[model samples]
Target chain A: MSGREAILGNIRKGLKRSGPLAGTALELCQTRLREHRPNLIPARAQLPHAGQVELFVQMAQEASATVARVTERAAVPAEVARYLADIGFAAEAIVAPDASIAGLDWSAAGVATEARHARNGDRATVAPAFAGIAETGTLMLLAGPQSPTTLNFLPDAHIVVLDAARIVGPYEDAWAMLRSERGEGWMPRVVNWITGPSRSADIEQKLQMGAHGPIRLHIVLIGD
Target chain B: MQITSPRFKQNAHEALGDAALQRALGNLKAGFPGKRAAAVARMPEFEQLRDAARDLKNHILEHLDFYLETFEANVKRRGGHVHWARDAEEARAIVLDICRKAGAKTVTKGKSMITEEIGLNDHLAANGIEPIETDLGEYIIQLRGEHPSHIIAPAIHVNLDQVSDAFHAHHGKYGKTERQTEPRALMNEAREILRDKFIAADVGITGANFCIAETGTTVIVTNEGNGDLTQTLPRVHVAVTSIEKVVPTLEDATLLHRLLSRSATGQEIEVYGTWSSGPRRPEDPDGPAEYHVVLLDNGRSNMLGNEFREMLRCIRCSACMNHCPVYGAIGGHAYGWVYPGPMGSVLTPAFIGVEQAGNLPNASTFCGRCESVCPVRIPLPKLMRHWRAREFEKHLTPQGFRFGLGVWAWLARRPKLYRLATQVATRVLKPLGGKTNRIGSLPLAGGWTAWRDLPAPQGRTFFEQWKDRQQAGGAK
Candidate 1:
């Protein structure tokens, strides 16, 4: 027998099942998978939209990411430029091909942005987050044509633009939003839940930032 | 990779005496458990979350076949391949075949205990494929040609100066001959060296923290982002995990993730939680072109229905080890296997054999700290006792122990004889107490009293004292 068959056979024997579940067990398993019921949502995540965004900003900062709030979508370019100037960086960045970012006039804000994935020498990548999670101050980025996964990594600095409206209370809510947007059965190739800049404590348990990914993660929040 | 578990007593004795290992083990108390306590204090519902996590795993284990089949189907739907391996050799063969098909000259690896369990690096190197460990700790241990001492912190046994020497010896050709004394500088040097390996590698292999059956996604949580670079930069990406890692949905995975990082490092979440479902898309600028998953079940299938079934609920959090007093004393190397601490004590016997690993279960103090801190509530102490019971039943325990326990059990069955025996023993040993009221040494108990004195029996046995108090009409 194949390895798959033998392994599955052992599992069946271990479970003491003569065959697959016939009625309730099978039905319950299918229903649970389809429903995807979340267990024990933290009370901290049960906040209003404004409160959630506030919590997200607070948590993101606590995780060592810089957060800047802008009033509108058009203001994102200027905010990115300001953050770069404040951090003593160049005006150039590798921007994601997402239409939301592509349509923005970055050059108008005195920033030279190219629409592509990050390369070895890329200093920064400007991308749009699918959602911002308030519970842990995390940014949810889905991989696709608009938001290449490489843009999340493979760069010295990562500049993300998250709309305040897109912020959710926790990871479960983020999953629900994805189901609603992409349909229940569909999933992106990659789902990145980035809390902050990369770090390592392998040496003497001393934390040093920017291990392999971005050294600085500056979030440009597109709302009050 | 080798089972040196039968020599556990000797290994532990040596580990306790090793100056360098003792110094490294000193950091365990100051590091792991405190952060976990603080993180748990903030979340009021953390206990409830643990229950939820435990139940979900139990649900999946009962219907593992169905979930595995569903996971395979989803991966196929997303244009990925899933290979099932009944044991270690088959798992190694499947991974080697993938590397050969990819024509991989060099493979970059993320930190994976499963890889350590299967001895993947040696296997790949024997087949003329260079495997580079990208994680900083794993890299250090790999350089020293040693197995991981700790699951999460592979090089926890190595000190800074040792890391410096290892790097200096190997990095001479890279124009980095100067020894880096500072941790920051050492980390930067590793980053610089591993950067080239990541870009040049033909294949990447990582272990999945969870395999979501709903979307066919493999999730990896890492603070260093090495796992990310390993999976993303290579032409082919392969995830090697055990069969028990499969979960039903992303929601379930998220709850477990909430507990894992906090318990492991006291962080609310890891720096990066990357989930890869398949290979890169057509319009994607960069990512692996091919994706594969190798699911290995060396002995987990047999553990499913047995007394050790709860062991499968382990998330590799290291909370059990961090809180383990024995682990704190001996460090991970003394456990003499891939896993250590309370979890290892129970699991080692299952993976290896009771005869070879009986010493591990016997090594515990039954402090119950590991089970209390366990997010899944594994009842690790109870499991260890189960192993001890099995060992005794199979006559794996030493003859001396059997004789001693048999004598005690035979005496304890008759209450009157037990009282008489204890009273006589107390009377005989009272004079030996001396001014210190402690026994410095005793026959058959030299092992226990070698380090410290055992307290002598005070005035009388409890039975005699109780009878005297009753005669004096003491308070009931």
Candidate 2:
């Protein structure tokens, strides 16, 4: 028999089932996947909207990402520039191809930006976060024509501009947002939930930052 | 990949004496456990989540056939291929076939214990395909011609000097000859060297943390972004994971994901939890052109029908080893297999044959720390005891051990004789501890007394002490 059939056979033998489930038994198993539900989300993730934003900021900072709040979308460039200046990075950066971020007048803030997928040599990047999870201070970025996956990892420093309105309290809430927008059956090719800068405690168990990904993660929360 | 578990006693003995290894193991003891405790303290519903995860896992295992078929169907729907292997040899053959079809001259790999289990890199290299490990720990160990000493932290046994030595010895070919002492500098040096390989690799291979049946997604939980680069940058992305890792949905994966980093490193969450479906969509600007999943059975399917079924619930978080006293003493290399520690103690016997790996289960002290820290609530100590029982039943234990147990069992069956023998032995051994009240050495017990002195009993045996107390009216 083929490996697939043999494996299935072994599994059925182990479970002591004669064969694959048929009729309602089969549907019962499939339904679990089709209509998946969250189980016991931490009570901490069930906070109010403003509380979620506060939690996200606090948790993100705890994960070692610098957070800054901008009062308006119009003030994003200035905030990004200010963060770059504080960190001693150049004002120029590679930006993801999102219209919301691209349309921003970065030049007016004296910050030079190139809108494209991040190249291997890019030192800094500005990407748009699809959602922010307050439960763990994670940013969920979907890979699309507008947002490239490379923008999340191919740089030394990652600067993401997230709308405070999209900040969520639970990881399930972030998934719910995707389903509500794209329907239950559809999914992006890649969904990256990044919490902080890349790190490794691999060598001697000594914690080290910037391992094969961004060294610095700076989040600019646009709007209070 | 090599089975040295038959010689685990010797391996552990040498490991204990290697001062450098002991120092590295000391760091391991200082790390992981505290972080896990802190992370558990921060989450009030941690136990609740663990309960839910354990049930979810048991449920998945019961319906394993249904989930695997569904996961395969979803991957096909997402324009990906799912390959099944009944054993490691078949798994390696299938991977080699994929590489050959891709015309791959070189491939980049993320940290995958399964790939290590199947010994895929050697097969690929033998076929003239260079395999590059992208994870910093994996890379360092790979350069030193060593397998991962620890699963999560692959180079946990390698100190800073060893890492510098490996980099200094190997990085010269890449035009880097300077020695880097700081961990950050070493990480950067690896990043710079691997970036070129990531972009140039013909295929990218990684292991899946969870293979979701709901959306045809393979989730990789990592702190480093190397896995993303490994899967995203190449033309073909191949994910090699075992059959038991398949879950029914994204929600199930998330629940387990929540417990993983916290238990492994005490982080609230690892930095990157990347979920990949198929290759990049037509409209997508970047990602691989093809995606494939290789489901390896090896011996796990056999384990499911047996008493060791609970081992399948493992998420490979390394918490078991983190708190495992035996693992802390000897480190991962001494386990002499792809897996080590409490979980490995159970699995190595089941997967590689008990006769060859029987010593592994015997290595544990049954402290139950591994089970306590286990997120899936696997009864690791109970399973190790089961292995010990199996070893005795199968007559795989050493002749000396069997003879000792046989004599003890004979006396144990006769309580009067047992009590008489113990009382006499206690009196005779008492004089040996006359001055120091500790036995310096004893006949046929040199192994126990060689390292340190064995404390002598201060007075009579437990039964005698209990009789005296009852005579004095102190017993309840």
Cα lDDT tens digits for candidate 1, B1-476? 77889899999999989999988887767888898999999899999999988998898999999999989999999999999998889999999999999999999999999988888998999999999999999999889988888889888888889999999999999999899999888888998889889999999999999999988999999988899999999999999999999999999999899899989989999999998998988877788999999999999999997999999999999999999999999989888888898989998899888998999999988989999999988999999999999999999878899999999999999899999999988887887889999999988799989988988888699989988989889654
Regions of candidate 1 where Cα sits further than 4 Å from its true position = B462-476
Residues forming the 10-long window of minimal summed lDDT in candidate 1 chain B:
B467-476
lDDT of 2 by residue, B1-476 (tens): 57799999999999999999999999989988998999999999999999999999999998998899989999999999999999999999999999999999999999999999999999999999999998988999999999988889888898999999999999999999899988878888888899999999999999999999888899999899999999999999999999999999888999999999999999999999999999888888899999999999998888889899999999999999999888988999998998988988998888888999999988877889999989999999999999999999999877999999999999999999999999988888888887989999999989889888888876588899888888889654
Per-candidate TM-score against the hidden true structure = 0.97, 0.97
User: Per-residue lDDT for B248 in model 1?
Assistant: 94
Which structure among the candidates has the greatest lDDT? Answer: 2
Cα TM-score of candidate 1: 0.97
Model 2 quality (TM-score): 0.97
Predicted complexes: DockQ each: 0.81, 0.87
Candidate 2 clash pair list: none
CA lDDT, candidate 2, residue A167? 95
